[model samples]
Target: MSFGALSDIRIVDLTQMLAGPYGTMMLADHGAEVIKVESPTGDMTRPNGPWHTDDAQKTHGGYFQSVNRNKKSIVLDLKSTDGRDALLALVRDADAITENFRVGVMEKLGLSYETLRQVNPKLVYGTLRGFGDPRTGHSPYAEWPAFDVVAQAMGGIMGITGPGPEHPTKVGPGIGDIVPGMMLAFGVLAAIHHARRTGTGQFVDVSMLDAVLAVCERAVYQHDITGTVPAPLGNGHPFMCPFGQFPAKDGHVTIAAPHQSFFERLCDLIDVPALKDDKRFASPELRGRNREVLEELLAAATSCFTKAELMQRLGGQIPFGPVMQMDEIAEDPHFAARDMIVPVEQPGSARATRIAGVPVKLSETPGGIHSRGPYLGEHTKEILRRAGFTDSHIDRLQAALPA
Candidate 1:
């Protein structure tokens, strides 16, 4: 029940969808008081699926529930003078503010870093964009729309994600969105710490394209120095042999024998002792040279065992695991024990729902979702009260809601 490290922090979150919201959720999980400011229409993800079948009324789409917990929600149309002014008041005492709007939107709203710093010099301001801000490149479509897929494709992840150029693939999850959010969260915290020390807040920027490139660092380095585009090798490590996915009886198992010794150990386990002595397969470098033949031998050995048997016998012996699906992850005992899957009660819904839990664990002050994601404007009155507005003030603001 106690959020650990960030118990004293307060954040005003004006982000939507994935990146910004996910970042704030990290802070919220760790006990920060995060106030989510939404338009009257609410966060776009609120209606995104995996809704509770038993009860529809309380559904806050699985996406929203997954990323938004342990936070309060307040409805404010930023375009409204009353709403913008109210947010500015909240900013005065807030530790941080996070947004993922396209560049220049905040500035147009008169809430840019320069403006916010004038009000509260120690406020950490975090922002995210599809590409970097205009300073990096002249985006012809600077105001063009974008999402996870666009970032992955444009940022070079898709170029090296599959078997070949003709079959480029995107990762299973919206990693493009999620990774930037994580990086931004860390940046926010870093800025927060520095601001607390020096009484000076700084802007924290995370671009989805930049984040994808960072994730694909190997590809960038190889291309920059070697003048070779890293091709998609499927699940194989480009430089490491015997360190990729192989077919099991029913499914695939990923193996990671990064070093020569581990490759020998893997061969011994699979009863392929001759492979250990083969000159073309002896060292990591040589194995890479004979990758196809080695893979064929491994496939033959691995095909005899079911994934479960292979895991039991070889999981810790070498770095190996079965390619798991969502259902498999839900049923995993280790995941359950680690509290990776948590059941949350959504009021007004017929049945309780389960979702992924907070990843970062703190021993002394563990953090978790305190409540389900808020209904649109669920805390409007409360947030207004805290912002030093009287009931009459809130009523006036309500009357001004955009038509």
Candidate 2:
């Protein structure tokens, strides 16, 4: 049964891998009927593994399961005329479709946006690419294939991230893909809304490089306004003092006391109340100017206490928190209270495996994870039947799929 906000919305997902699957996952979690149309071999990530020891049937690994959850899968060989017809049948009733293929892949398959729109004029076609589709705007690097690292570097995040200017580091998570995926989801919803109002749908294009650059907004304005290229400042902020990670007795803790009142309170809690009045740190501008000296002093004081001890001392008084790892986060009461970690019964595993919970909370109609990721072509017959295909037609379609 469908649950969550988008229960009436249907999506034909012709996307695979991290970026596209992630965007559709968000929609599926919110009760969209997401029909994942895959080829005969299935998504490439099905083979990527961090398999559970107890799960012998390794149909999909963690990477695939994590993003493809709460969706149905069907195998379709778009190269075949019958397969293309089947997809078009599904599209006729679908509100939107998403893909992440290269510039010419969809056109080669005879399933371009112009082609799909003919089947359903109200179809919102969303695409995520390294440079973006030509329908939105052409880029010089449109043909260049890119992954997370390439987007991170070319988008300017890597230029101003990491320990120093000499050593640019990629962000730990795949924000390059994930962010663009999120934007695609938002765009799809917006286009769908417009379609409902005016009975016209449009193409939604999101470039991975553009998404990353949008996220690195600070660097853009800083360079344009001040004529200075931004560089990595380690864990510290360019304008704020005492706003980065500091060493504790056991580990690191983050402290952000940039405001005057908060800074004074932080000084008092750390037993260095005199620092609030010091000429080098009396004002926010002065503290930023002499950040190195102030950080050294604060580090000396903070290093004497453990992370837990520091948390206890300044938990609510100032904006402070200990740097948490996965293990710690799993056991934390805050995560439990917020439902940030959810356990679902994995298909092959004897015990339930944990994945992150949905972050969006709606008071009236909340979203959730109702099911685990589907096995390859798990709902093919069911989906085909629902799309008005006869048993004989489904058999023909299945037979035509690549072996």
Candidate 3:
């Protein structure tokens, strides 16, 4: 069997919920050895929805299973001296350790990077916090907890999402968790590369607020250039003409008519030659000034055709796509050809369910889903044995219910 690009790396994942675990899962998918240290009570997401087909075994929640494949799990209570010692043993030789604990939790356990450095100087310590590392301010709520929606609201995503002047909407999906996870994973890989080259490791920190702000990069710049805050435009582009969702006979399709040439192509393709010469629709600036008129005219033309017919007629002529639902995506032929959805078998009799495959495609050392994530502490004995503990010692350690 061939290992993937990150085959030599090992990651000690001490994250729950979404952000930190998502980062480690990214590494695991690329062939890193990720050992998820769960508390005696498993990850909170283990109880989240779309549970396995079996009514009895709620252990394998689809939410938990989705981002956590290609990793092992080991139950440990870090507050216990013995458990911390075991973690130290693992960290002494591991490449990286990732956590999303609120600030000070690791120090409370005496396992912060400063302490861990004494055990392994080459350890790449990565952390994700809601605000930031406690260095900036002793915020009154410094140690307060946070989740995805809170991050989005605090970080400015909610301010720019909705349609009307009074309403603001948070984006769909937990981008608060996902963006930080992607950034942290990139940080980890960069640190690993540096460690491999210079024989050193450094701290990598990401804030949920900071990550969300990064995703709102354009909005910040717009706010800076103009004294006015940008309002939500819904399915419309703020600066580009004919660049938004248009109604179809059955549904809606997005048209990114950003350039003048493309805009001309769109008008021509829709058989609206008179629009090309109309005073209000002649230029992008003019079109923006009379958006309602243009939209009504375009909607009339588009509403006459089905999405399939429109796509067949103007597929390559314009930047166009249907606003697909999740069910629609599952049946898309292009998605199938790309192998975006892959099937994996589980313990249930319902056969196997489909999950997303790896996105980063390499020519030689490509990544893949090697195996499903382990049951809680499924590799406890195996890990202890590899850590040089004897069989009896392993048994004793496992039997001890650490704090």
> Which candidate tops TM-score?
2
Q: What are the per-residue Cα lDDT tens digits for candidate 3 across 275-348?
A: 88788877889888787778889888888888888898779888999878899999999888877788765543
TM per model? 0.96, 0.99, 0.95
Of models 1 and 3, which has the larger lDDT? 1
- Of candidate 2, the 10-residue stretch with the lowest lDDT total is 344-353
- RMSD in Å for model 2: 0.8
Expressed as tens digits, the lDDT of each residue in 33-99 for candidate 1 is 8899998878888877776666647447778888998888998888877888999999999999998
lDDT of each: 0.86, 0.92, 0.83
Name model 1 segments beyond 4 Å from true: 135-141
Q: Between which residue pairs do clashes occur in model 3? A: none
User: Which ten contiguous residues of candidate 1 have the minimum total lDDT?
Assistant: 50-59
The TM-score between candidate 2 and the true structure equals 0.99
Please, what are the lDDT tens digits per residue for candidate 2 over residues 1-403? 8788999999999888898889999999899999999999999899888889988888868888789989999999988999999999999999999999999999998998999999999999999999998877999999999898999999999999999999999999999889999999999999999999999988999999999999999999999999999999899999999899999999999999999999999999999988988998989999999999999999999999999999999999999999999999999999999888987767788877788889999988889888888989999999999999999989988987777
Worst 10 residues of 3 by lDDT: 344-353
